[model samples]
Target: MTHEEKRAWIRLIVAVIAYTAYVVVILRRAEGGPLPDVPYAAALLWTIGGAIAAAILAEIGMAIVNPRASRVIDVRDKEIGRFGDYTGQAFVAIGAVAAMLMAVAEWDRFWIANVIYLFFVLSAILGDVTKIILYRRSVPTW
Candidate 1:
């Protein structure tokens, strides 16, 4: 696999795993109480930080495991990246709108924060998936 593809895989895996861990932690804490009442800020922050650390570490490990792996970035790579970013940004916009609406409706901070976090994770996963797919197949030209 190419270096970029490996990076994409790392991102996808890390995002999913981090989000899942956060959900599990939050749910466990909510077993006997309201979800909003659960202590989620620490868990959310930790998971986000952990995901970033894990992805960086994984990339470093990959480089160590295959020192000869090509790290070249071609025009196709750039195009595929742009495509993935554009594809993923939709979720971010949606999340922002949702959060704004929630805030206007006077929803709990927990719900608004979680929605934003969820969309961020989804954006990463979708972007990574798109990059991987384009790498495996072809990137459409405009």
Candidate 2:
């Protein structure tokens, strides 16, 4: 696989693992209690930070293991990246709008924050999946 494809795989794996871990922790904390009152901010922040760190470390490991892999970017990489970014950004916009509406409605901060975080994680997964798919299928020319 290409370097970019490997990076996408790494990100996808890390995101899934981290998000799952966060959800599990939150659910356990919510046993017989309201989810909104489960003290999720720390878990959310820690999971996000851990995911970022894990992805970076995994990429570095990949580079170390395959020292000869080309790091050079070409036109295809740019096109695929643009396509994936656009696909991912749709969820971000949706998340922002949802959060804004929640705020305007005076919704619970917990709900609003969780919604935003969920959307962001979905965006990453979708974007990484798109990039991996494009890499496997070959990018189409416009």
Q: Could you tell me the TM-score of candidate 2?
A: 0.97
* Structure candidate 2, residue pairs in collision: none
lDDT, candidate 1, residue 117?
100
Compared with the true structure, the alpha-carbon lDDT of candidate 1 equals: 0.94
RMSD in Å for all candidates: 0.7, 0.8
Q: Write the per-residue lDDT of candidate 2 for residues 1-142, one digit (tens) a residue.
A: 8788899899999989999999999999999799988999999999999999999999999999999999998998888888988898889999999999999999999999999999999999899999999998988777
**Clash totals for all models, in order?**
0, 0
Across 2-107, the per-residue lDDT of candidate 1 in tens digits comes to: 8888899999999999999999999998997889899889999999999999999999999999999899998988988889999999999999999999999999
What Cα-based lDDT does every candidate model obtain?
0.94, 0.93
